[model samples]
Target: MLAIRLDEPKQFRQIAIPEPERPGPGEALVRTHRMGVCGSDISGYLGHMPFFRYPRIPGHELGVEVLDVGPGVANVKAGDRCSIEPYMNCGTCYPCRKGNSNCCATLEVIGVMVDGGLRERFIVRADKLHPSEKLSFEQLALVETLAIGCHATDRGAPTDGDHALIIGAGPIGLATLEFTRLTGATITVMDMDQGRLDFCRETYGIERTVQFKGDGSELARLEEITGGDLYAVVTDATGNVKSMSNALNYVAPTGSLVYVGITTQEISLPHPLLHRREVSVKGSRNALPADFPRIIDLIERGVIDTDPWITHRTPIDKMIASFDSFTRRETGVIKAMIDVSGVS
Candidate 1:
C-alpha cells in the first residue's frame, strides 16, 4: 500500500507500507477517496503543532468507501460512502462517562496523535463512520471540519434574532459563519485579510464585515454595527493569541465568548471588563458523534455549500511538490483537497 508520511518537519516522502489487515471485530477497512488538509496539518509540517509526533500519516478529514467489514459491523457495508470521524475517544474516561466523548481524557485525533487516512487504504472503528447516501466524497470529507464549527456555535446557544460576531474568515470561520447564519442571527465577520472578508460577504451572504486592524477602530466599527450593544456572542477562530485577546473587547455585556481556536500560550484577559460584563467564557473542542450526521444532512438538504469551499486540489503524486505553496499566505488557498485515490 502507498502512504505519505511526515518523517520530519518540512519533509514528506511517499513510501510503501504493509496493507492493513482485514477489519477486526468492530472495525472496517475503508478506501481513502478525499482527504482535506487542515490547519493542524500545516502546523505539524512546520513543527508548530503541540504534542504532535513526526513519522505520522497526516490526514483526518476523510471521505471514504467501505471495502469490507469485520463481524458485528452494521451501520455501513461494502460500497457505502461515508464521512470519517477521526477523533478516537476512550469510552471509560470521566468526560466520556458523562456523554462528552469529544473531550475524553485519552482522546486520539488521527493524523495528530496516530496514523491517519492519508493513504491508499486505512482501517477505522466502524462506530466512527457516518454514511450519507446523498453526499459526494468531497462533501463527505468536509463533514468533520464543518462539525467543528457547528459544535462551537452550539456551545454559545444562539437564538433567532441574536447578533453574532465571528473573527477570522478562514475555513473554520466560514463553517462557523454558515451554522451561525442558520441560527437566524444577523452575522458579522472580522478578519485581517480583505479577500477573506469579501468572500464571506459575497459567497456566504454575511450581513456585515469588519477588517481587523490592531488599532481600536475595529472595535468602534463593530459597535457601530450593533448600535453600541456589540454582539450577543463573539466567537474567535483566529488561533492567534493577540487576536483572541483582542476579541474580548467586542463581547456584549451579559453575552458569551467562545474560543474555538486553540493556542498553547497562556492567555490573559481584561479582568474588570469581563467581570463587569458577566461574560460567559467557554472553550469548544472536537465535535460530538451527533454533529457529523447532522452536518451531512444539512449539506444533503442544500442548507450548506461545500463545492465552492474547495479551492485547490492535487493528485497524491504531486502533493509534496505543491503542499508548501498552499501554505503561503498570498496563495489564497481556502481548502486544499488531496485526491488519495488518484495516487500512482
Candidate 2:
C-alpha cells in the first residue's frame, strides 16, 4: 500500500506501507478515490495551520468506494460510493451527546489533527459514510467542503429576504456562500482576488461584490451596498484575523456573525460595538452528520451547481510536483482533486 505523508511542513513524501488491517466491528475498509485540496491543506503544507501536528497524512475531503464492511455495519456495504464524515468524535462527550459532534470535546478531524484518507486504502467507522448514487467521485469529494458552509449557515440562521455579507471568496468562503444562498438571503461577497469575486457573481448569480483593500473602505462600501444599514447576517470565512475582527462593522443590529474560518491569533473586538448592537457571535466548526446528506440531496436535485466548483484534477503521482503552483495560484485553482484509485 502507498500512503502520502507530510513528514514536516514544506515536504510531502510517498512511501510504500503495509496495507491496513481488516475492519473491526462497525468499521469499513474504503478505497480512497478522490481527495480535494483545501485552503487549510495549503496552509498546513506551508506550516501555518494551527494545531497541525507534523508527519500528518492530510486529506479530509474524501470520496471513497467501500471495498468491504465488517460485522454490524448495516447501512454501508461493498460497492457503495460514499462521502465520508471525517470528524471523529468521542461519543460520550457532552457535545456528541447533544448532537453537536462537529465540536465534540475530543474531536479528531481527519487530515488536520490526525492521519486521514490520503492513501489507497483507509478504514473508517461505517456510520460516518453517507452513500450517494447520483453523484460522481469528484462531486462526492466536494460534499465535505460544501458542508463547512452548510454548518456555518446553520449557525448563522439567515432568514428569507434577508441580506448577507460574506468576507472572502475562497473555497471555504464559496462553500459558505452556496449554503447561505439556499436560504433565500441576498448575498454580497468580498475578496482581495478579483477572479474569485467574479466567479461568485458569474457562477452563483451573486451580483454584489466589493474588492477588499487593506485601505479600510470595505465597511463603507458594504454600508452603501446595503442601503445604510449593514447586512442582517455576516459570515467570515477568510481565516484572516484582521478580516474577522473588522467584519463586526458589517453586521446589522441584532444580526448574527458566524466565523467559519479560524486562526491561531486571538481576535479582539470593540466592546462598545458588540454591546450597542447586541450582535451574536459564534464559531462554526466542522459539519454535523446531517450536513453531508443535505448538501448531497441539493446537488443531486440540481439546486446547487457542482460543476463550476472544481477547477483542477490530477493523478496522485503528479500532485506533489504541481502542489507548489497550486498554492501559488498559478493555475487559477478553485478546487483540485487527486485521483488515488489506480494505486495498488
Candidate 3:
C-alpha cells in the first residue's frame, strides 16, 4: 500500500508499506476513495498541531467503501460506501457517558493519533462509519469539515433575523457562513484574503465582505455592515491568537462568540469588558454523529455548493508535488481534494 508519511516538519514522503491485515471483530477495512486536505493537516505539516506525530498518515476527512467487515459489524457491510468519522472515543469517560464523545477523556483521532487515509487502505472502528446516500466520494469526504461549522452554529445559537459576523473566509469560515444562513440571519464576513472574501460573495450570496487591515477599524466596518447594532453573534475561524482574543471587541453587548479554530498557546482576553457586556464565549471542537446527516442533506438539497470549494484536484500518484503546491495556497486555493481511487 502506498501512503503519505511525514517523518519531520516540512518533510513528507510517499512510501509503500505492507498491506493491512484483515479487520478485527469490531473494525472494518476501508478502501480510501476521496480525501480532503484540511487546515489542520497544513498545521500538522508545519509542526503546529500538538497531537501530530511523525511517520503517520495525515488525513481524517475521508470517504470510503467497505472492503471487508469483521464479525459483529452489523450496521455496515462490504460494498457499503460511507463517510468516516475519524474520532475514536473511550466510552467510559465522563463526557462520553454524557453523550459528548467529541470531548472524550481518551480520544484517538485517526490520521492524527493513528494511521489514516492518505493511503490505499485504512482500518477504522465500524461504529464511526456513516452510510452515504449517493454522495460523490469528494462530497462525502467533506462531511467532517462541514460538520465542524454545523457544530459551531449550534454553539452560537443564532436566532432568526439576527446579524452574524464570521471572521476569516477559509474553508471552515465559509462552512459557517452557509450553515448560519439557515437561521435567516444577515451575514458579514471579514478576511485578510480578498480572494476568499470574493468567494464568499459570489458563491454563498454574502454581500458584506471586508478586507481585514489588522487595525481598530474592523469593529466599525462590521458595525456599518450590521446597521450599527454590531453583530448579534460572532464566530472566529481564524485560528490566530490575535484575532481570537480581539473577537470580543466586535461582538454585540449581549451577543455570543464562538471560537471554532484551535491554537497551541494560551489566549488572553479582556475580562473586564467581557463581564461588563455580559458576553458569552464558547469553544467548538469536532462534530457529533447528529451533525453528519444534516450536512449531507444540505449538500443533497444543494443548499451548500461543493463545486466552488473544490478548487484543486490531484490523483494519488502525483500527490507529493500536488501536496507541496496545495500547502503554499497556490492560486489562492480554497479546498483541495485527493482522488484516492485514482480518479477525479
Candidate 4:
C-alpha cells in the first residue's frame, strides 16, 4: 500500500508500505476514498506539532468506505460510506468520563498520534465512523474540518445579533464563518489573505472582511466596521502566535475570545487589558460527537458549502511533490483532497 510518510520535519516520503492490520473487535477496516489535509498536518510536518511522530502516515479528515466490520461492530457494516472522527480518547479520563471527549486526559489523535488516512486503507474504532448517506466522498472528507469550527462555536456560545469577528479566512476560519451564520450573528471576518477573504464574501455571503496589512491601519478598519467596538465573540483561527496574542484587543469588553487554532509557542496576554475588560479567553480542541451529526445536517441542508472550499485535487501517488505546496498555501489552494481509490 502506498502512503505519505513523514520521515522528519519538513520532509515527507511517498513509499509503498505494508497494509494496516485487519480490524479488531469494535473496529472497522476502511478504504480511503478521499482525505483532506489540515493545518495540524502542516504544523506537524513543520515541527510545530509536538505530538507528531516521524515516519507516520499523517491524515485525519478522511472519507472512506467500509471494507469489513470487526466483530461486535454494530454502528456500521461492510459497504457503508462514512467519515471518521479523528480524536481517540482515553475513556477513563475525568473529561472523557464527564462526556467531554474533546479534552481527554490521554488523547491520541488519529493522524498525529498514529498512522492516519494518508494511505490506501486504515482501521478505526467503529463508533468513530459517522455514516453519511447523502454526502459524496469529497464532501464527506470535510466533515472533520467543519466539526472543528462547530466545536468552537459551541464553546464560544455566539448569541443572536452579536457581532462575531473571526481572524483568519483559512479553511477553519471559513468553517467558523459557515457555522456562525446559523446563530444569526453578524459576522466580520478578518485575514491577511485577500483570496480567502474574497472566498468568504463570494461563497458565504459575508460582507465584512478586514484584509490586514503589516501597517497598523487594519485595526482602524476593523474598529470602523464595528462602530468603535469590536466583536462580542472573537475567534482566532490564524494559528499564528502573534494573531492569537493580539486577539484580546479586537474583542469587545467582556467578549469571549476563542483560540480555535493550535500552536506550540507560548502566547502572552496583557494582564491589565484583560483584567480591565473582564474578557473571557478559551481554547478549543478537537470536535465532539455532537459536532459531526450537526455538520452532517448542515451539509445535507445546504447551509455549508463544500464545493467551493475544495480547490485542488490529486491522486495519492502525486502527493510527494504536491503536499508541500498545499501545506504552504501555494497555488491558491484552500483544501486539497487525495483520491486514494486510484492508489496502485
Candidate 5:
C-alpha cells in the first residue's frame, strides 16, 4: 500500500506500507477514493498544530467505498460509497456518555492524533461510516467539512430573521455561512481577504460583507448594517486568537458567540463586555455523529451546493509536490481534494 506521511514540519515522503488487515468485528475495510485537506492539516504541515504528531499520515475528511464489512456491521456493506466521521471518540468518556461525543475527553481525530485515510485503504469503525447512494466521491469527501459548520450553527442556534455574522471567509466560515443561510437569518460575512469575501458574495449570493482594514472601521460598518444592533449569532472560524477574542464585540446582547475554530493560545475576553451583554459563549469542536448524515442529506437534495467549494485538487502521486501550494494564500485554495485512488 502506498501512503504519504508528514515526516516532519514541511516535509512529506511517499512510502510503501503493508496493507491493512481485514476488518475486525464492528469495523469495515474501505478503499479511500477521495480525501479533503483541512485547515488543521495545513496547520500540522506548518508545525502550528501543537497536538499534531510528525510522521503522520494526514487525512480525515474521506470519501470511501466499502470493500468488506466485519461481523455485526449493518450500516454499510461492500460497494457502498460513504463519508467517514473521523473523530474516534471513546464511548466511555464523560462527554460521550452525555451524548456529546464530538468533544469526548479521549477523542483521537484521524490524521491528527492517529494515522488517517491518506492511503489507498484503511479500516474504520462501521458505525462511523455515513453511507450515501446519491453523492459522488468528492461530495462525500466534503461532508465532514460541511459538518463542522453545521455543528457550529447548531451551537449558536440562529433563527429565521435573526442577524448572524460569520467572521472569516475560509472554508470553515463558508460552511458556517451555508447552514446559517438555511436558518433564514440575514447573514453578514467579515474577512480580511477581499478575494474570499468576493467569492462569498458572488457564489453564495451574500450581499453584506465587511472587509477588515485593521483600522476599526469594520465595527462601524457592522453596526450600520445591523441598524446599530450587533448580530444575534456570531461564529468565528478564523481559529486565530485575535479574531476569536474580537468576535465578542460583534455579538448582540443576549446573543451567542460560537468559536468554531481552535486556537492554542489563550483567548482573553473582557469581563466587563461579557457581563454587560450577558452573552452566551460556546466552543464548538468536531461535528456530532448525526451531522454527517444530515449534511449528506442536504447535499443530496441540492440544499447545500458543493460545486463552488473545491478550489484545488491533486492526485496521490502529485499530492506531496502540490501540498505546499495549497497552504499558500496566493493560491486561494478553499478546499483541496486528494484523489487517493489514483495511486498506482
Candidate 6:
C-alpha cells in the first residue's frame, strides 16, 4: 500500500506500507476514496500545531468504501460508501460519559494523534462510519470539515434576527458561516484576505463583509454596519492569538463569543472588557457523534452546497509533490481533495 507521511516539519515523503489487517470485532476495513486537506493539516505540516506529531499519516477528513466488516458490526457492510468521524475518543472518559466525547480526556484524533486514512486502506471503528447513498466521494470527504462549523455554531447558539460576525474566511470560518446562516441571523464576515471575503459575498450572497486592517478602521466599519450595536454572536476561526484576543471587542454587551480555532499560546483577556459586557465565552473543539449524520443529511438534501467548496484536486500519487503549494496562500485553495481511489 502507498501512503504519504510527514517525516518532519516541511518534509513529506512517499512510502510503501503493509496493507491493513482485516477488520476486528466491531470494526470495518475501508478503502480510502477521498481525503480533504484541512487547515490543521497545514499547521501540522509547518510545525505550528502543538498536538501534531511528526512522521504521521496526516489525513482525517475521509470518504471511504467499506471492503469488509468484522463480526458484530452492523452499521455498515461491504461496498458501503461512508464519511468517517475520525475522532477516536475514550468512551470511559468524563467528557465521553457526559455525552461530550468530542473533547474526551484521552481523545486521539486520527491523522493527528495516530496514523490516519491517507493510505489506500485502513481500519476504523464501524460506529465512526456515516454511510450515505446520495453523496459522492468528494461530498462525503467534506462532512467532518463542515461538522466543525456545525458544532461551533451549536456552541454560539445564534438566534433569528441576531447579528453574527464570523472572523476569518478560511475553510473552518466558511464552514461556521454555512451553519450560522441556518440560524436566520444576519451574517457579517471579516478577514484579512480580500479574495476570501469576495468568495463569501459572491458564493454565499453575504452582503456585509469587513476587510480586516489591523489599523482600527475595520472596527469602525463593523460598527457602522451594525449601527454601533455590534454582533450578538462572534466566532473567531483564525486561530491567531491576536485575532482571538481582539474578537471580544466585536461582541455586543450581552452577546457570546466562540473560539473555534486552537492555539498553543495563552490568550490574555482584559478584565474590564469581560466584566463590563457580561459576555459568555466558549471554546469549541471537535464535532459530536451526532454531527456527522446531521451534516450528511444536509448535504444529501441539498441544504448544504458542496459545489463551491472544492477548489483544487490532486491524485494520491502526485499529492506529495503538490502538498507544498496547498500551504501557500497564493494558491487560493478553498479545499484540496486527494483522490485516493483514482476513480474520482
- TM-score per candidate, in order? 0.98, 0.98, 0.96, 0.97, 0.98, 0.98
Residues forming the 10-long window of minimal summed lDDT in candidate 5: 46-55
Model 2 poorest ten-residue lDDT run = 322-331
Candidate 3 segments whose C-alpha is farther than 4 A from its true place: none
What is residue 305's positional error in candidate 6, in angstroms?
Answer: 0.7
Clashing pairs in 2: none
lDDT of 6 by residue, 232-251 (tens): 99999999999999999999
Q: Write the per-residue lDDT of candidate 4 for residues 156-269, one digit (tens) a residue.
A: 889899989999988888888778888999999988888888888988889998887868887898889889988899999988999999888888899999999978789999
Q: Each model's C-alpha lDDT?
A: 0.90, 0.89, 0.86, 0.87, 0.93, 0.93
What would the per-residue lDDT of candidate 1 be over residues 1-344, giving only the tens digit for each residue?
89999999899999899989999999999999999988788878888788578889999999999999999999999999999999899999999999999999999999889999889998899999999888889999899889989999999877898889999888888888889988999889999999888888789777699998877899889989999998899999988889888777899999999998877777789999999999998899889999998998899989898988999999898999999987776798889999999865
Q: How many clashes (backbone atoms < 3 Å, residues ≥3 apart in a chain or on different chains) does model 1 have? A: 0
lDDT of 1 at 79: 94
Write the residue-wise lDDT of candidate 5 on 253-333 in tens digits.
999999988888999999899999999999898899989988998999999989999999899999989999998878999
How far off is residue 282 in model 1, in Å? Answer: 0.8
Candidate 3 scores a C-alpha RMSD against the true structure in Å of: 1.7
Residue lDDT tens for model 2, 142-209: 99999999989889998898989889888889998888888898899999888888898889888899
Off by over 4 Å in 1: none
Model 3 residue 87 CA deviation in Å = 0.7
- In model 5, what is the error at residue 317, expressed in angstroms? 0.8
